[model samples]
Target: MDRLHARYPFLDAARAAVDEADVDLAALVRSGGPAVDRGVGRVESAIETGDVGEPRRVRAELLSYPVARVVVSLVDDPRLTDAYARAEARTAHERFVDDVEGSTPVSLPEGIDLGRLLAEFELAAAVDVGVSVGVDEDRCTVDVGPYLRLASGLEGEEWRLVARDLDGGRVPVEREELYVLLREAVRERVLAGLPLSVPEPVAETLEPEVERVARSLSDYELPRSVTAELTPAAFPPCVEALIERARSGEELPDRSAFSLVAFLAGAGADPETTAAVTGLDPEAVAYRHERLAGENGADYPSPSCAVMQAYGDCVPVEKRDERCERVDHPLNYYATAVEEVSRSEP
Candidate 1:
């Protein structure tokens, strides 16, 4: 137990709080029902056992209470922890948005209360709203790219911006509505597996910027073209769909080419035919097949057939083997090709 205490700093404080009754632990329960005294028994049970396991579990349960809710329950609620979490999220998003906008903190229409919008969503722990805006030179477009973290399961951040006609405000064109639109505008450039900025260790750090963009967008009331220039954001359309479905516990289609190929092979697709369709070399196709076979507990049909199945391309294994013989290792050729291609590209 002492060893566990030394490892986890929070356990000691949590134990002290529970022992002294200094904290109104009941106030931390989920808001769905009548006051449930689950914590008191749980804490007592853990302390009686004197086993390290109980304390660890108890600490986790206590911390699971949303920081905001915890503050509300406390008498002299210092919203320090909750406020810091929100600030961290906002700063990360701002850094991302700034990178997208060429470092010009993209401002929104005057009177669009971004701070309030974020507060509303933060308190709710999730946000789903709409904004309409038009394009201009300075605030030409409001980028939602920074808000990706919020949209996923972490804090449930999502928005749809529909463009309204200036005259009649009809024929709404939602900025994030179309697949191809997001693919070309946001996905292709930014968010293509790029790492977050220094301040953004986690998704929460970008929350503020996301809120700013969301609120500022409500005023423009016109559909504007926004750019997606980040690496991880390279596939905004696909990423968004995946995120939404994942949040709802739904399965999305396999989009990665490699994963798709693996899926088809596992489902019992013929190797030779699959290779031709996928344009992969025969041996490569068989390698994937072998992997799937191992996972499925099936015998490899044939090494040659497996090769053909794995490659999923027109190239024969015989020719590939000849090519492989020239290189010290099979990967050497691939590495050299990658380098050459990178160097040759603009």
Candidate 2:
């Protein structure tokens, strides 16, 4: 007990809190030696004055003693937020032990309070879960938390909540599906000794969607003109492609195919730059576009073109296109591209 205070002072208050508990909870010791009683008395006196220093010091001392930790952990029940108050008082001890056991040992200076650590974890959980968490005198709301979003296969949120709950000693067996996925993902990435950091449950939930979009872009090249505006996070496919190419010592499909197709569809590019970027003579790129247009015989209508058609503004540019009209031409081209791509698939 003395060793713990020297190492971690917050546990003093924790032990004090447990000792002062008037309730007949099994986690506390009803009576003990003068040493224990003195420790509790000192801590309780401090709590009455809002200082908690005496108890804080005692709690810190109790850290070296595992029996104290077990008792402290049991004070908070998972089902009720009211239990958070009890848990809060014990959290510093928990963190101190966890930190000591983890690869990173926490060495807190004197005067560091346990309440701060308790609030920090709760706030972090609230933010990471994208839920609104607030606690008042006796009411706490977790409505915006993971469980609220399960209607959309937002199992990721639920998974994260379960992990938090489990850590807090509140296990919800019904969330086994989420727990399994989280456990699998964690073990797969962590146990393999991978360099990647563990992703939050929110991020894991969106992993499939991100990967799906990325795979769609595996063969689909990005346009040079828009490359500056697009970032890896925004275009997960491009990022994945780049990463895979680097790992395999292979090149991804060039931007030329995409650029050429767009140009053929009437999205012209500057002559010099297109030639340089594609490694094709400027004339060749232009000729290919012309050839495609000639074969398709409709200049591969753009969305703007479709918009113009919809608005009956299908007048030829040579005849004078309007400057003020909105065109769905881009949408038409997009639809056509989708159709062409689908049909091209063998």
Candidate 3:
């Protein structure tokens, strides 16, 4: 648990939030009575109207009450506002980049002056530029920090500075766009708070009353132990494609890599098993597993298909056997497959 906390320091607050009994929504709402109802009504109205700024204000007001925080999450409704969901997910991605950049430092390749590159794009005057380059085996990747978009805007096109391998293909870069993206994430984290792993008795009591609001919480019910037995045949096409690429020593997009790791971890695969399946580094897989796990040892669900597609990881295939459209999250495929296998055995 200490190791898990050390690795995912961001989740410490979430762990604490879940453990506290005072966070129970029913109790809070019952105590607050009319005030809580009025607040919920206002937030719901803001959500229905798609008022961007209003939700933030509502979220702020609701933060004092743990139940109200979950109410805010439900009312904000990521499914209703896909743009909002994407933004939140993007923030998660940026945080991943920040973590990677802080831990792994890479030197820029010789003769590649970042200043000169910025000057070439007329972005030198706009912002301070810093470059962190990572090299794995023969592949080289470059991260131009958060200012790439600013630079791109100045250039008037989608201009990006990429590090190329000897063969001239794009490689991985740990881009920290935190400065630009952190505000919403911080707000969402505060508003939604962390999902607690409610015990079966507690969950049963709250489920009927807070069912809609509960769905807005992060996945908190995933088992600690590997319960679902997965087979290679049951692997989703997208996951299979990812595994094939990983095996061939290809770099995956950060979001895809994250989704794969989270999916494997949530589906009861141990770190070593996850690494073996995805061809990712064992240590990296282990860290990712721990990061996704909640205080009660349940793992979070994988990012949904929309997130995967937004990150360009969703490969469109012609005449696919499985209905990808039916699957929402990547883990859904695994979960469904496990159920199907179990039913067939009986």
C-alpha RMSD values across all candidates: 22.8, 25.7, 14.7
Off by over 4 Å in 1: 1-23, 26-33, 37-141, 148-346
The window of 10 residues in a row where model 1 has the poorest summed lDDT is 221-230
Off by over 4 Å in 3: 1-208, 211-227, 248-258, 280-302, 317-323
Residue pairs with backbone atoms closer than 3 Å in model 3 (clashes)? none
The CA lDDT at 138 in model 1 is 29
TM values, all candidates? 0.18, 0.18, 0.42
Point out the worst 10-residue segment of candidate 2 by lDDT: 75-84
| lDDT (tens digit, per residue) of candidate 2 on 1-346 | 3443444333334445445644232222333333334333322322232121333344434532222222212221111111122222333334443553356655554333223332423322422211222323222222334332321222222334435444333233332233232222222221122122322442343344334333432222211122121122221222233333434544323332333334323333344544443455467556544433322212222223333344343444454333213222333233334445558779
Model 3 C-alpha lDDT per residue in residues 156-270, reported as the tens digit of each score:
1123343222123332322233222232333334334334444454344434435543343323211122346557676667778778888888887666777777666666677
Model 1 residue 217 lDDT score: 27
What overall lDDT, based on C-alpha atoms, would model 1 receive against the true structure?
Answer: 0.30
Relative to the unseen true structure, what is the C-alpha lDDT of residue 335 in candidate 3, on a scale of 0 to 100? 66
Evaluated with lDDT, which candidate comes out highest?
3
Model 2 ranges with Cα > 4 A deviation: 1-35, 55-60, 63-125, 128-346
lDDT of each: 0.30, 0.32, 0.46
